[model samples]
Structure formats: C-alpha cells, structure tokens
Target: MDFILLSILKTAIAAPVLLGTLAYLVWIERKVLAHVQLRIGPSRVGPHGLLQPIADAIKLLTKEDFIPSYVNKFYYWLAPWLALMFAVTAISVIPVGPVVEVFGIKTNMGQADISIGLLLILGLTGMGVYGIALAGWSSNNKYSLLGGLRSSAQMIAYELPMAMAIASPLLIVNTLNLREIVNAQAGYTFGIVPNWNVLGGGLQIFSFIIYLICAFAETNRIPFDLPEAENELVSGYNTEYSSMKFAAFFMAEYCNIITACSVATTLFLGGWHPIIPNELGGQFLPTLICMFFAGVLFYHALNPSRPSDRLSMGVIGAVILGLGLMFQVPVVKDLAQPLFWFASKAGFLIFFFIWVRGTVPRFRYDQLMRFAWLFLFPAALLNLLVTAFIVAVKSN
Candidate 1:
C-alpha cells in the first residue's frame, strides 16, 4: 500500500516536471541551433521565445486531428501513443539522485528502483520502435512504410553494438540495478580523478564512445538520421500524421534523447557524484554554477541583446540568483546538490546532441548500416571481451 502511494506521488511530481522540461528542451535546442548558425531563434514568440513551447502546444491541441480514409484506423491511432508511452516509461527506472525524505515520506528520486532496472529500460526502449513500424504499415503510403522499415532496420542494426558497449561498463560496475550502478561509480583517484567508467575506474573510453555513436542512431539524431530524411521520404512515416498525433511522435523523440542522456550520465559519468570530493567543497559547486549563470543572465539583461530582453532577462537572472542562494540552505542543499550534479551532466550530454545536429551532415542509409554492422559491432564486442579479461585478472 505504501509502495503504491509513494510511486503515485513520485509520478505526480516527476511527470509534470518532465513534461515541462520536454517542452523547453525543444526551445533550448532551437535557440542553441540558432546561435550556432548565427541567427536569433524564437525571439518573436515570447521574450527570447520562452513562450514558444506554449505556443506550439496550443497550436497542436487546436489543430484539426486529421485522419486519412485510406489509412488503417486502429493501428494508426495506436502508433504515436505507443511511441510516446514507451519512450516516457523508460525513464522511470533511472536513478536521478540518492534517496531522500520529505514530510515523513522516504523514497528515491525516480519511479521504480528494481534490481533489473537496466533491463527494464532496455526492453521499454526496444518496444518503442514497434510503434514506428506499425505507423508506417498502417499509413497505406509507400513513404510512411519506407520510413517505418528504415527505423526498424536501424534499431536492429545498432542495438547489437549498443548492448555490447553497455555491457563493458556493466562488467566493471557488476550490477543491473541503476541506483547500485550509480553508487558503484563513486570516489576519486588520488583525490582528484573520478573513478567513472570512461576514466580511471574502468577506462571504458572506447565503450563510452561506441555507446554514444550508437545512441545517435538509436534516437535518430543527425549524422545517422536516415529513417526520416525528409528530402527522400517526404517527411517519412510522420507525413500523414497531424495535430496531436504528430505532436506525440515529436515529444517521443525528445524524451528518448533525454532518456539516452540520463542513461549515459548514470552509467558512464558517475551519476549524481560531483567531479571533485566533498572535502574539497564539492557541495558548493552547484551554488557557484547557478550564481555564475545568474551573472551571465543579468549581464545580458543589462546589455539588452535586444531591448525586449531587458526586463525578461533580468527577471530570469534574479530567479536564478535566488535559486543559487537557496542551495546555501542546509536542508535544501542536501537534496538539491545531487539533483544538480545529475542534471548538469545530463544537460551537457543533451547539449552535445544539439551540437552534433547543427554541425554534422546526415549519413547515407547504406553507410549508416555499414558503419554499425562492420565497425561499431566488432569494436563493441572486442571492448567487452577486453574489459572482462581485465576484471578477471584484477579479481584474481
């Protein structure tokens, strides 16, 4: 009874926060991509396009829900929801921070903390592509069908290397539980270098690199985004989708990106652990970072990138500065610090995704498959073998 209630409470808090983040993530991506291209993006929608996500949500909700007479009604209706559900569900088992209590209730940061959390995430993410496949098949259009086919093939081709890359880290951490995996990554070498999988702990750098490359393909990000190459497929499987249906797939893609980033942070980057030791004032890092950003926002506010940004930027800066101040509170700092570190690492990974999209060109379909099968798969497999051997020798 308590478990059910706690789970429900966690979901209540997390769901809205996550949904809000997803909305702004799109805004962030656009603004970032715009800056990369020397353009001002989303400024007209709201103060610096802060309201753009809200505008988009309203548009999607108010638009006519289009359905084609030629399409298969049942499956077409089911596809987008399925994709969104599976994508969102995968995040539930991820451990964002250590356990904490509020109002006499104690619980972990995420929805579920099971022993098989990693497998649960893997299973949910794998099943998500079925929605894409079904959408294509049900559309009764060659383009949509081709998109679906490409996605299914992409998932299958890349999953092998991804799984193998993931396994190399597991051999070092030796647990399927996500929380336990994060805990195992704690501590530093010589009181400086973190014992993260990508570094001193296990030196799974090759594995980390492989996992990231495969993640791009898994999420259909640029340089590997052949599944819905609009030029070739006329917007691909989503061509016939409109209104909320289209929005569902759109949200699913972003959610998947976030999920992938979270997983990487947890498994490779020492989830929730600061780069430096607490004795060295690791606890104060969050406050410092927030204050730093607050300063930047205030500077921008005063200088006024555009006159419209002065008030908005100043308001945002003040709020950020207040947040930095709050972290100094003893009680709030305990909870906020771990969450901050987790968010920072995950946020950087997410930004990397946006960066790659702006800089890299899309790969040809055959080249994508060939790279996954011929190069990534073999490299991942070899890394796993090498990691197992090292762990075995060290154990002996």
Candidate 2:
C-alpha cells in the first residue's frame, strides 16, 4: 500500500538525518563554547573541523568497550541504547512542515500524525529516565547511584512545571494533537505579527518562558546539568560506560535537546509558518538569507585566509550561490520554504541552548531543585489556571 511505503520512506530519510544532526550538534556546541572562551575548537581533523564528528565517530567505534567487574552487565549494556531509542522515537509525531505533494503523491512532512502526539512525547520522555537510573544503579558505584537518583528527582520535579506550561497552550488551542496546535497558530494579527502562541493567541509568554526553563532542566542542560557533573559525579551515570556505549548516551542527550526545541517551535513558535504572511514577501526571506551567506563565503574565498581556502572555500561558495539561485524556481521555493522556516525557528532555539551553556554557570544541586519546585512550579500552575479562566470567558 502507498501508506506503508510512504511511512517506510519517511523513516529512512528522517532517521539518518536525525543521527547526523546529533553528531554535528556536539561539534557545534564545542565550537560555540570555544569561541565564547576566545579559543579555537576542533579544526585539525578537517576543514574548520567539519570532519571532526566523523573522526570522533571512528574513534568511539574503535575504542575499548570496557565493562567493570563489579557492574551488572546486562542492564549496563542496555541503558544507553534505551535512552537513545526513546529520544529518537519522540521525533516521530512532530511535523516539520505542512502537507505537500511530491512526485504527485501527498504526504505529511513528519513520520506520524497520531492524535495523542503530545502525550506520546510526554510518556516517552518520562520513560527515558529509566535508562539513566538503570545505568547508574547497575554500575554499582556510589557516585553513579547518587547521579542517577539526582536525575530521577530532577526529572520528576521539573516535569510538573513543564506539563503545566504545556497545558496553558493546550487550554488556548483546545487540542492535544501537535499538528492541530500548529495549525491553530497559523494566521497573523494586524497583518504583521504572527499569531503564534507566544505572541498572539495565547499571549502565554510566561508559559513559554516557564516551558524553556523546565526544558533546560528536563534535558539536564547547563545551569541545571547536575546528573553528569564531572567534578561532582566523575562523569555521572555513564561513568562506567566506554566507547560506543558512551557515545550513545552523549548522542541521546543532544537528541533530546533537538526534540525539546522542536516541540517548543511547534507549540509556541508556529512549526512551519513564516514569521509574516507569504503575501508580504516572507517567501523571499530564505533566498535572501542564503544569498547573503553565499556572498560572505565568496568574499572570504577571494581573500583566501588559508592556502587551502582558495579551492575549498571557493567551491563551497559556488555551491551555496547555486542553491540560493535555485530557490528562485517556483517548485523549489514551494517545497523548501516551509522546511526553511521550521529549521530557522528550531535552529534559533538550539542556538539558545548552546548559548546558555556557554554563558551560564551550573546551579548548585539544592538551588536547581528549589528553583524548579518553588518558583517554576507555582508560576506554571498559576499561568495554567489563568489561561483556563480566559479560555472559558472567551468561549462564553
């Protein structure tokens, strides 16, 4: 059947892309943090370290897959893969763009369009904790046990605020389906600003802020990254893990970050919607951006900072320029623009994650818990109540 084939096709395309993105996200984080500290990151492996991920992958694959004598081998072996599976699975229900016709067959951009998509994400993410907890416990290390317990507690504490913040938007839209949540945020107000949940319809800016804060905690990202605190926990739950298994755990964390950003983009920022209406030249924005980057690349190519740059940079610049020109084609524009907007919004949020890591200090354990329960939980709860009241009044 066409449906089954399409599903297979989507999975094939999305899975590799997601995996590659997870790998590069690590490179991006390092480069960003390095620059923030006035240092160059990985650059020797390949051009500007573009091949760094590949090199790292090879290293991880070839390294010793060590197991501690004291640990439970079965559960220790299972944890990283389990974490990765759930992280990647959450992407299934997230629509990256509107429905489009390709090769005369209509298909949704995402893999699945389940009705209870939000609930599925929540359930899977909640289950991801089992991987971390099991990893720590099975390692039979006191430090790993402490780290695992901390992660479990942190997830439980922050999930309450995160769910409440998510609920505030659901109250406004009156839907549990992720696509419908995005569709409800389609139009603009005053023909200029988008009717996104954060801006127009829900005006749930506080909710958005609360969601982001909780997201940081939920993903165990810095200022709240106590689980893997190197100095405190000696690399935390995966301390006993090595080689490819360790890489799997690292990949899962970035994958979760990507999922969090994607969810936020879909729920609050309008998933694939342009910032302004298409009629207002919003469609041209991507072309303009690509061309601008192309121009910059060409300029650098001409300048030739490094000896190798004259050839490599010039070729890359030409390729970018060609892609920019391709966006002028009506068919290409139609197919690619939605993806562009979705990527832009999600990319910004991803950058924000890295930015926070570079600029913010890690929270002391007690401080992290206190902030989530005392401040974030109450704020999210109040926002949800107010949102419900407003929705009720408006419906009447």
**Candidate number achieving the greatest TM-score relative to the actual structure:** 1
Reference-based TM-score, model 1: 0.98
In the range 61-95, model 1's lDDT, one tens digit per residue, is: 99999999999999999999999999999999998
Give the TM-scores of the predictions, in the order they appear: 0.98, 0.97
Clashes of each: 0, 0
Misplaced by over 4 Å in model 1 are: none
State the displacement of the C-alpha of residue 189, model 2, in Å, after optimal TM-score superposition.
0.5
| lDDT computed for candidate 1 | 0.92
What lDDT score goes with residue 274 in model 1?
94
Q: In model 2, what are the clashing residue pairs, if there are any?
A: none
The local distance difference test score of model 2 is: 0.90
